[model samples]
Structure formats: C-alpha cells, structure tokens
Target: MSTTRTRARIATILAGLLVAALFAAPTAAPAAADPTTRHRPSPPHVVGTATVPVYSYADAIRESVWVETPADSDGDGVRDRVAVDVVRPREAAAAGVRVPVIMDASPYYLCCGRGNESELKTYDAAGVIAKAPLFYDNYFVPRGYAFVAVDLAGTARSTGCEDVGGPAEVGSATAVVDWLNGRARAYTADGRRVSAAWSTGRVGMIGKSWDGSVANGVAATGVPGLATIVPISAISSWYDYMRYNGVRRAADYPGYLHSYVNGRGEQACADVLARLRADSAEETGDRNGFWAQRDYRPLAGRVRASVFVAHGVNDLNVTTNQFARWWQELAEQGVPRKLWLYQAGHEDPFDVRRGAWVDTLHRWFDYWLQGLRNGVMDEPRVDLETALGTWTTQRDWPAPGTRDVRVALGAGDGVTGTLGGRGAQPGRERAYVDESLSEDALVAEPGTGGSGRLVFLSGALTAPLRISGSPSVRLRIRVDRPTTELTARLVDYGTAERIRYDSSEGVRTLATESCWGASTAADDACYRDTEEITAVTDHAVLTRGWLDAAHHRSLRFTTPLRPDVWYTVTVPLNAYDAVVPAGHVLGLVLGQSDPDFTEIDDRDATVRVDLGRSELVLPVTGRAGLPSVAVAPSVVTAPAERSSARTAPDNRQVP
Candidate 1:
C-alpha cells in the first residue's frame, strides 16, 4: 500500500480509539444543586451523572401495603382495596433521603404472568416481596430508585371486582398515587395505618400491555405526584380494543378477560362480569356509555405528567389505532411527550432492543423523576424502527412531510381494476359476493375474474413510495341485503424479506441469557435473549380496515340500506408506516367478512361497486417524490402481468 493510504488508515484507527476511550472514562460527579431550578442534588446513596449502581440491591427494603380506593366494585357497602408491593434502597430510607418511585401496577402479577418469560411475583415466608418480576427493581434500586409493584384491584390479593378498563380498574392506580402523595389512606398487613414519609411523592409508572394501559388511565386522571409514564404497546380506548369502526373484532371480550386475569375466584366479581357482558352491546357493536367511561382520549387535557409512549406498528391485538388516536389527542392538548414506534407487533422494547431501551429509560426517569439536568427531553421526539435492526429518528411521528393523496380506481375488463391519477370511466362497475374468504383468495388472480372480492392495482412504481399514516377507502356500492361486513386491505406486491410482525409478535427467544445490572440470589436482572423474526414474501398487506356497512354513517346507530340503492361509505384503515420499493405495485383488495380478522356472521349478500366513484386516499410522505400521476402509469393490467420473477413460501401476509 502507498504511504499516504497507510497514514490515512492509521489516523482513522486512532480516531476510533480516542472516541472509545472518552466513553470508557467515568463521568465527573454532578455539581452542587441550584435551589431556583428543578435540578436536585444527588443524595449520598446516589453517585452518578445520570444514575449508576452505588447502593445495594440485595439489601433493599421489601414491604407490602393495601391502598383504599373510592370504588365499591363488589357492592358490599365498602370501598375496594388495591394491593401494593414495594422495594426500595435501605440506605436512602435509613439516611432519611426520600427518593422518587418507579411503579408497575398490573393485573398479571398473579395470573397470566408478565413479559416474554411470563414470570410472576413471588413472596417470602414473612409475606414480604421476595422477587419482583422485571429488571426495574434489581437495576434501578441500586441506583437509588425505588421500584414498587402493585397488583391491580380485582386481581391477586386486591379486594375488588375486575371491571376491565372501567372506573374501578383505573381507580386502582390513581388511589395508589394519591396515597403516595399523602392524600389517601394505606395500611400494612397487620392493620396499622402507614404514610409514605420516606417518599418524595414523585412517581413514574412503567409497564407493557394491560399494565401500561393502567398507567395511561391514571395519568389521564391528572393525579399529582405522577412525574411521568412509559406506556408500551398499551390500549387507550376499550371500545377500540374490542371493536373497529362499529365492527366487533373481539366479541364478548370484557367478561372473558376479567375471568382470565382474576386469579382469586371471588364470587362477588360475578355481578361485575355480568354487567360487563350486558353493557358491551355485542349485537350492534356500537360505542355506548360503557366505552365512554373507559376512554382516556377525552381526558387528555387533564394530564399533568409527561408521557413517553412506545408501541408496535404492526400490533393487531391492542392495535396501532389505540396509540395513534391517543398520540393525536396528546399533541392537541400540548402535553410533553416522546414516542418510540417499533416494527414488531404487540411486544415490549425490552425484548426488541434491550440495551438501548434500558439506557434510554434510565435517562428518562432521571430527568423526570429525579429532576436531573439530563438532556433527554431535548433529543428527537420520535424513534421509529423502519425494518429489522434499522431505526430512524424524527422530530415527530407520521414523518415530517406526510399528506393525504387521493389515488382513483379505474375499470378493468370486469375482472381486475386499475389505480391511478383519475377514477374509472362513467358507468363502469365491479361486483363481488360475501363469502368470508381468506386474504389469499381475495388477492389471488387479480388480473382475472374472481369471486368474493374486487381487486385494484397500481402500476409498478418507478420510485420508492412511502406511506406514513392511516389510509381510507371511499366507495359507492349497493348490497342486496340490509348490511354486510366490508374489508379493505392496502397491499405491497413485490419480493422482499420483511419482519413477520404478525407471527409471534416478531420475536423468538434464545436460550442464552444477558444481565443488565447488579443481582442477588433472590432477585436477578438477567433475561433470555431474543431475535427478530423475518420472512421473504412476494406480497404483504400493509394495513387493513373493517366496517359494518349499515353503521358507516354513525357508529352509534345503524341505517339499513335499500336494495340496489347506491350509498357512499368510507372505510378508515389502520395506521401504518412503510416504504414500497420501486418495482413493487400497490394493490387494494376489497371484500366482505375477512375470515382472519372479523368474526361477524356472513350475510352471503351480493354487492356491486361503481368504479367511477371509488378511490383510495393514502398518507404519502414527500409529495414531490410522488407526483400526481407518479403513483402508477395510467394503464390497466392484471397483477400477474406486472411480475412473475418472485415467489414466497407462504405466498402472502395472512391479514
């Protein structure tokens, strides 16, 4: 090699070494606190810029208490009590150094379990907490932070009926916050009243799924002392959880879920279960007083604590709409917020990106709960996983330059249709039958005549087209029956390996283990390793929407359609973020009663579509990159003619 090349290479190596050495060096201790600012001085037990293990984890104090709530869910003329298990640093309490809290209130503490390993909380012989399930206690406790675990009311040892996400369930968390702030009552196991004198009255609630949901609910109540919350793949509305656009997705789920999570077999909760079933209104799948009471979006203005939200883009169980809708409201309310959107489905960030997740969380808590002068809030507002192991940061979600673009549908030779800059010619029509078919059948043979579905295809793109938000489909159609289930899917047709987010939440656990922080014999911070699951497919459904035709105009009531009368209806698809490759075609498949997602009975009605009045509206990013006529060439062709060089073992994404 030339001397110049060798010298340049040596300089690069030296620069990398210098960077590594700077990071390996220890940070200087924080300076004296300023009383006028929010920054607080580090206590004797805490000794780090952000936070580190300076205290003993094994010697942390372990205790349990019962917090009284104002809800009489069991209706025995008494208020309900929520069970709380707490672990904190012994040195902080001994030295009278009150510290903030990191709490996880969950119903799964005793039943169904938590996290990827499904670990449950354990107790010692003296009835004190022996082991808390996650790494929060073992790691944060040694960093001078207390980790409190609470079994939500109606589950485990708590005395109340499980009301799903109703007032009783929400009260379970708010009451605990109230007690920590010295505004409510709490008692020890021996019946002696106690106060949270050792606490600074600042709390940060963090959890996944149902546990995270409770955090959202409590934060919405505008409770004081709640410094911040980290809700991972959580639900914001119970109505959206069980239904979508007036279509029941999980029918009779409230009562079934209550029974599944309640481990105590208390007969008093029987009436609560009956009430849940009765108020669900499964017959009409309409939003009623029951769902209104459980929704947190309307109360977004009341939130006082900052929020750090994380959710999966492909989550089908709690679904992405839950977070999208809630995030929009939080933005409108001008709440201090941050977001992390992953490519996986219904999974926690701990399993997806453990090391980074832990480090980021530590800084977030230090800034919000400990009042540290950490620059975590000044960082980017959104962290999105674009693909497996590939991430990008943005100032906000839905990308910076996202806008809705209307792509019209054109007529195909009665079998297939075209999607382009303009709608089909006047009087053109396409028809289908209600057969409750799988997506595979609905999207198959798009170039030829098919049964049970109508297919529209955009020409293979010349440039990568990125969609950043929800898409909606508008159609003018007539059904032979009063009402029928309508399913619309936005699909990407090309051969590319993608994360199988729908399959097992996009992760598979390995036998190897990794440790996060200090550990003891009773409680360890080690967890099994996990890897993302991916597959090569010819076509993948980007997002889908389902609607009950009769309730399209109003989710609260139904309007029966007259036979052969054309009525325009809109189907709002789920939120999604993805980029389709240049050679890939964007397809729209319209059918009735999707067997994979909806469980409604099939009406077996014939339906006809007016092609000239149908269109697809997509939230496209970088409008200049995709011009008005750039979506696809103004050409009508079968999907088969577009490409035959690609193949996949599974053929397609199920939904």
Candidate 2:
C-alpha cells in the first residue's frame, strides 16, 4: 500500500538537457516574443480554451530522452530505462517561462498507437521523435503547456523487459515524474545532462485506457509536484480489469496484452513475457501479491493532486466498478475532484463529447496550473450522459439524497418471474444450466426462460424510473456443488425498439470530420464525425455483476462452499445512470455463465434460491429526473404477487 514497497531509484541518473523544439533558437514574431529568454509565454490564458492557438503547430519541439529505473523488468539483469517524448510551446521556453506539463505515459505507443487515428510515433535517424501520436501536442502546446509522451519501460524505444502491469511498469513511469521535478534524472543520447529548466516542475497526467492507468499509478505514490490527473477509462486494479472474483474474464489476459504492446521482438523479452503468464496465476485466478502491487485504490489517501475522472457506463473493457471503486476511495479521502459519466463504451471523452470536454479541461488546467479563478471547481461536480446522448449536471454522483428500492423475485404466470412482489414466487426455486450464452440470448425473450438463464420482471412500469448509481444483487441461496461462479444482469425488456448500444460498441464514426484545435502535417487535431451508436432491440442491459461462489466470503480469500448450505451474499453491479421508461418491463436475469465474459467452468452446480430472502437493490432518486416518460399509477399491481416483498430498508443508501 505504500510507494516505498516497490520504490527503487535508477542508478544511471542523467540530468535533463535542452529539450530540442521547446529549446529552439529565438524566433522573430510578436506573439512568439521573448525567444531569447526561452521559458515563459507572453500572456497566460491568451486564447483561454483547450484550443488556444498561440504557439506554432508545425514548430512545437519533439525530442526524446531516456529515464532509467531500478527494476529489471526485461529480465536482462540491467535496470530498465524509459523513453520520454517532449512537445512544448517553443515560445514559452524561449521566453524563459517555465510551463506546467501535461503528460501521457503509455505502453501502447509501439503497437496499437493512440487515439481513434491509431497513431504510432515516428522517429528520426538519431532515435529522437520526428512525430508524436495523438493531438495533445497539436492542441495544448499552442496554449502554453508542455506535453510529454512517455514510453513505459520495455515498450517502444525504452530499454527493458516487460512485466505487464507489475512493479517494473509502475516504477519506471514514476521515475519520469521524479525526473521532471528534479527528484530523479534523465539523459540525452549523447550522454548530456538535460535539466527541466523549461518546466515549472508541476505536472498533470492525462490519458485513456492503459495510458490512463499509468496516471493513476503515479499519483498513488503520493509523489510531490504532480499537480493533477485526468484518468479516462483507466484501471484502478489490474486484477479487476482481468478477473471478477476468483473467475477470470479471460485466462492470462494481461500476459497476452503485455506481449502485444511490448513491441520488442517476442524473443527479446521472452522471459519477461513468460514470467507474466506464470505470475498471473491463471489457473486459480486468485488475487495475489502481484495484483495487490498493481492496485492503486488503497493509495487514494496519498494522492496530492486534484482528480478529473471519466468513464462510460457501457465500457465492458474496463467496466464501471474499476472507476467507481477508486472514486469511492478518493471521496473518502476528500480529494478535490470532478467527474463525467458518459453512456459510451471503451471511449475517450474528447472523442465522445469533444467541445465541452475540451472547455472543461481548459478551465481545469488553468485553475490548477496557472492559478486562475475559472470557477471550474465551483461548478457541479458530476456531469452525466443519458442513453440518448442528452446530459445532466448533478450535485453529486448517485444523485445526492437517493436511496435503494429492493425488488423481490417471484414466478409469474408467464415464463419470466415477477419483480417487486410482496412474497416469494409460487415455486421454491428457479434453475438454469451453466451453459455459456451471450447477453443478447439471455434477454431476447425473457418471458420465455432461456436455456441458460432465469429472468424475473417487475409489473409493467406505471411511471418512469431511473437508477443513478450502482445496484447490488443480494441473494440467499444454496448450491449443489462446492464452488460456482454466478452472473446477474439488470435489463429492460419490451416491444419498443431502443438503441442497440452494445451492438456497435456504443459509438459509430461518421464520414464527416470534427476539428478540435489547430493541426500540423505530423499530427492533426481533427477527427471523424461520430454519432451515438443506436439500434432497435427488445432489450437493453443496464448493468451487470459477477461473483465466484468460492469468493462469496471475500475476494481476497477463497471459501469453498459446503453443499446444501444456504448463504447470503451481496454482489455490487457496475455503476450506471439510465432512465427506464414506463411500460417497459424491468427484468433481472440470473445465470451461471456469460460467454462474452467468463470461460466455461465444467463443474455444473444446481442452485436453489430462497426467493423470500433474495432481491435486487436499486439506487434511485425518489421519482425525480425521470422525464420524457409517463408517470406510474398510484395502485400498481402485477399478475403474480399482490403485496410487495421488498424486505430491505427503503430510502436508505446501499453501501
């Protein structure tokens, strides 16, 4: 839980020398004045936006230096070294105006590149960067910020073996931040010292996915001089990213990904890659020390910077739980924060909601870096996107003052059972085989119990209801086997067609273009037009949760079940903000396996549910924020149960 646990200083420290482009010779322009001074820009917030066009887009300096780390992740015995690419306002450096830095540290730069364009960095003859990936430099350097693109240890131009998401990867990135603050060192190719004279020593890390995950890792160190971070769709725990409970989302998923993004020939880092597979403990899929070392949630209280968190509800890749758990820790620590909960999947906010995202980022950086009174911190803390692309600003996430509404499961006259029933169903239990099935099949005709799942529905909604946060599935059940993994999904089923968000991965790029900032031949700030990915379907998955029966006691510890023993377990679903319209049936699908997520577990165990003690607890803001749908009737009644058996406390928050 402490930074010192894996901290090891690199011995071959190199002082940061002159950064080429940012340290360019003096220019002859009024806006680009003070070239002789070489550090500060003429005016701060000159353009006053993320796209402020002041610096030369074509002239932003692009250079690279190596940063050494103590971990020999490459297994070569020699400590690993990281490659850092810098792009900054040449005028700011020339003017002697030390600027705060915005950095994107990533391992994907070598393989998948970055952003929607899939851009990989282009290098010059001397191994310096000729062109960097993405639009951060194109857009922000002009606005007076230095942008650093770092190649994590063992990836891209860096020297080392890959350790996947282990300490080597985390420590290597942290070393770069240390170098920026003069707490560590960096060196040029010719062995020249490179001092960060062009920097204020204040840094803000930003990125999506793996890139963003690094940002979280660095901040967790409780390091000084890291001013802020904007982690978009990032991983808080590598364990959560690849596994749920004791069952894996995919066996050795990180090992496979580590090899893929390493860029080095497989043979060069073969031992490192092999070790990842062995250390991953894929067979048991249990949480181990390796997972704990990569976990950043426990270090939340140590973070010194403000956080701007963003995540999409439909991001099956990272899932909402990863973000929610970290965010919860940050809240408990009382760290300055802001959030944007979108409706897309595995996406970047800049790509989904470009303009607003940029403006907010602009203000955020200004307030933090330049010490401006932009009122960004004073604004509503949460901005939520709806299923239809509409948005709302909430005072706090989960819509402040909300409570849980428990809906019990009961068998109805039809195939699917009843939800929000007053008592247990006519049957003592409902059962399904542990056959793998797509979510589509499980919810397609919920009324007709699918082969792999049992669906329970509430009466036709009399009024619209929306869930602002995560939902939990509390079930009291007995299993015939010693262990089994269970999956539960919250869905909406009806005749009306809705956007098939999951089909297209939540976004569809259009033929047109949407420009964010200025552009250059090497990197353009414009991207393809993207509209909300939509579809007509009878079902829409609101959220889902999973648990290993063995993990029913604790994710950190395994407890094999005793057959025929009834146990009450609580499973927290991913967080979401969606409005379920009136007349659309709300259903809960309980199944043993999901083909898209879990691998097949051959041990089939019959599960017996005590319906009277099981229910789905939903977080809702009492009849508010449910616009565009008809109101519910006062006296609601379903075909199955007459009185509601919602046995849990009402109007009380769940955990």
Candidate 3:
C-alpha cells in the first residue's frame, strides 16, 4: 500500500480503538470482602523544621527566621521588623567551612505581605513550615550550601519607603548581605554576640521572574562581593513586556500592575492601576527618557557576575524573544553568559523539567561561587525540544552544519507531497483571493494550531536529517492589488503526523513604490507622479523582513522593486532541533495570512501564492542515527510425530 493509504488506515484503526476503550470500561467494581482489609497506607513523612538555613554569607551563615528582628537599619521612614532564612550544610561548623551566600530579595507588596506573614506565622506555630532561604529550597538547600531570603524595604520587617526596582531596593539587598556577614560577631544590648566569622564571604544572587529582573538590575550596579547571577524568566525591559511589537497590550498591563502593587487587594491596587491605565505610549515610547532611566541594558557590559539565563520557547506571557535579543546583545558585547531554551510555556521552569533547570543553575553557582570542579562548564550547551522528545547539545548557540535547501512551490494537480514535480516554471504564476476568510475556510487556530496554516512536505529521508542552525524562506511574488500579508511555517512531518517547528510573517505594501522600492504609506497616487523630481531612496520603502509572524519587519535589496511584478521576501527561521527521523518528511507551509497573528493589512487585496516563484530554504546538517530503538524476539518449534503415528494405527485397527 502507498504511504498515504497506510497512514489513513492506521488513523482509522486508532480512532476505533479510542472509541472502543471509552465504552469498554467496567461499569462497577467488586466490593472488598471486608472493609478493614482495605486499609489505606499512611502518607509520606512530612519533614518539619523550626528554622531553615538559606545561605552562608562571608563570615556568617544567614538563615530563615520564624522570629522577627527588633530594629530597622535604614531610617528612610517606615518602621519594620526583619527575618532571614538561612540554609547551610550541617557539617559546615565541624569542617570550619564557609559556603557561598545567595540572598533572595523578595518582591514587595506581592509576597511576604501581612497575609503572607500571617500564613507563615500560622505555619510556624503549627511546626510545619520549612524555612530554607533558596527559591527551590526543598530541592537545593540540602546539597551543602546556604541561602538567605530577605523581605525588601517597606515589606515584612524591612524599613524605608518601598522603592520597586530602584536604587533603594538594591541598597536593601546589600544591607541584608552586610548584616549576614556580621551575624556571628554582632552584639545585642544583653551582650549576646552574633556573627559567622568562620565563613568565607562568597556571595551570589538568584531570583525568578520579578526577583530575576531585580537581580539583573542590581547586578548592573557592579556591587562588590557579588559573585554570580542566575536569572530565570526575568523581565529585562518593562516596556517590552507591557507593550509588544509596537502595540499596547492594554488587557494585561493593568491587571499585572495591580497584582504587583496591591497584593491583589482592591484598596491598595486601585491608585496604581489607575495611574498605569492613564499612561500613554507616546509619552514613554522613547527609551531615552524616563523609560531609559529604568532600563538595565546600559549596565549590560558592567555586570561582573557569571550569568546563566533560561527562558521557555513557548512562553506566551513573557515571550522568549526578549531574552533571545538580550542574549544576542550580551554575546556581541563579550559578556560571560550561558542560555537554556526549553519547550514550555510560561512557568515551564517550575514544571517537571525544573530539576534540569535547577541543576544547570546549581552548576553555574557552584563553579563561580564555590569554585567546584563539577564539569558543568565542560558540558556542551543543551536545547530541549520537547515536541520532538529530544535533547540536543552543541558547542554554540546556533550550532554548526546548517545547509540552506530551497524547495520551490509549484502548481500541481492538488496532490500534496514533495515539491519536485511538473508545474509552473519561472514566468508562470497563479492568483487567489485575498479577502477575509469565511467561517468554513480552513484556518489555523491560535497557539499550537497556527502550525497548520501553510503546509509544505519534504520527500521521505533515507537517513535522519540533522538540522542545527537558523532556517530561512525566500518568496518571489506579487499580489493582485497593493498590500498583502504572508505567513510561513516549518514542520517536521512524521510517518503519521505533521508537527509544527517554527514560523514567521511579513506584510508587503506594493503600491507605494518610490524610485528605490515599496513604502509603508497608503497613498500611492501622490508619490507616483513625483518619482523623478523627488529622489527615491531605500529609507522610503520597506523590504525583506524577520518577525515572529505574530509580530512585524525592513528595506533594501540589490534587486529591483516589483509592483505587479514578482518580489521576493526572505524570512529567518529561528534555530530549532534537527535529526528528522528516516522515512519521515520535513514540511514548509506558506499562506497569504494567519488570523491568529495580527497582520498589518492596508489593501482591498486579491493575492496569489506563486508556487514557482516561492521557495522554502532548509538548512540540513549531516545525518544522525535514531537516538534509541527497541525490538522483540520470535520463537519456533518442531511437531510431535509420535502422537500422529499412534492415532493412525488405532484408526486402521478399527476399520
């Protein structure tokens, strides 16, 4: 049977099996003969501790306290109490060892508020709360180290006016670190000395999300004694998070700000939410003003700590693009940095894959803070592509061995398969409607479904295709009218299913052509006549682009600009995992538009997909074997001749 027919048959059988399983379940279960016989097993032991050690600072070991501090250090206005959660090895005292200190500056207003205090108090009184200072304390603290969790100024017991992401926040963190270093030698009125002079003062900083961003922000100050930083899913730019792709994301801004400022309380959040809502993009668009004052990019080169950054590929709320941009910029500036990309949405680091993430962070911390020979630095960088169920390692970000293979689109007899076939050549092109899609039109849904929008399949591979590097698609075409939107997606086609890998989009404004090329302006008539009088330059037109397909794109090409004539747009495909399985195909999908992504539409358009003119270029590396495989054995036996001979003799005697 043909591959298509075989696939259809397998799909049918699978559907039938699913339907049968749904109905075949037992309606009722047999009751136990005796209720006492079915006694439930006792739950796992719930380890409880009064105080957990978070981290060990230079001379002293900082710890988490169920008790509160009596005095406020800074006299900036707010009276407060403070407590530090310390984590350290039990053998530290006996070994006279000094572990690295990792201080956590808790987010004000959200965590460690009055309600949080009440909850912590209740848990403490009940003797059930664990007070390790590390973010993932239950997982990291026990491995021989110390962690400190501090309530920022104006929250918990810390004093001073609350300054979110400002210098005051940094000061508060530094103050805690200072306090920790003197813990063993400091004296109270009663003459009790507190300090950890035995400790070696190696300190590090780590935070997740808000904490992560603050850590990055604080690291920019070039604070002394700060060793390393591991910022995960951090917000580097506030403007980028609130406003994406030049569009204001009104829905998320207010709610997010309110949640952070008010601690989810109506009274506290009302004023902040109102102020944020009233803010205008025009007033803050330029990063050189107040926004620039808040940016950490300026401090990128100054951050002395060894940094490890991790972000999810499918993080919708905090898109990975910003992190990618930061990584690229840092790399260009020669900053010591490492990055991990995992297949996950927002909160991916907190999921089952969190261990590996934490492990990576721990390795970095150990190497920089403790000076351990854990071989973490020796390991190749890891890229976890969950969709393909594979973990790839490379020496560099983009890896190596990427080949650009362009597959041209062609007009065929509606039979979907590989690109090579007898179809329209160079000069021949076909046109299709570019109106709003009808309800019945086959369109991709949001999120994962967007992968189905445009489809191209590669021929079955005799060997596993290893692809490691950036991929790009080049399309040469023209729309029936002026402005049109285009979306392209790359897919890994299995023997049975097509899985989306990556995608990008571009908007072409054809009519506004200057002497140089096409422009973004809507009015073409005004500029068409003065083409010669006014010098037309590349700046007046928009050209080849790279966008998240969900986002925007540029101008300039040595090739002439075409109006009704065919024009080519080249889009970069984000780096992805290679090693496509043998007998499976790779697919490239191109469409006029994708509704899931907001595209800039400027014309009442009729568009055509010029197959002969359009091509999907793939960067194919050398082949690799399947990562793993399993097989079963068969059995055989001889016949029993004696039994047959006895039966024949008996029959003859009866006859």
Number of the top lDDT candidate = 1
**Cα RMSD for candidate 2?**
10.1
Off by over 4 Å in 1: 1-41, 45-48, 624-655
lDDT of 2 by residue, 540-612 (tens): 7789888888888777777888875788887778888787888777777888765556666646677777777
* Higher-lDDT candidate of 2 and 3: 2
1 or 3: which has the higher TM-score? Answer: 1
Please estimate how well model 2 matches the true structure, expressed as its whole-model Cα lDDT: 0.73
TM-score of each: 0.90, 0.86, 0.55
lDDT value, residue 528 of candidate 3: 18
Superposed on all Cα atoms, the candidates' RMSDs to the truth, in angstroms, are 11.7, 10.1, 27.2
Ordering by TM-score:
1, 2, 3
lDDT by residue (228-343, candidate 1, tens digit) is: 89999898998878777787775567877888887558487888888999998888988889989989999998887788999888887778888888899888887778999888
Which ten contiguous residues of candidate 2 have the minimum total lDDT? 646-655
lDDT: the better of candidates 1 and 3: 1
Writing each residue's lDDT as its tens digit, candidate 3 over 93-113 gives: 556655556766665422533
Which candidate order results from sorting by lDDT in descending order?
A: 1, 2, 3
Write down the lDDT of every candidate, Cα atoms only. Answer: 0.81, 0.73, 0.44
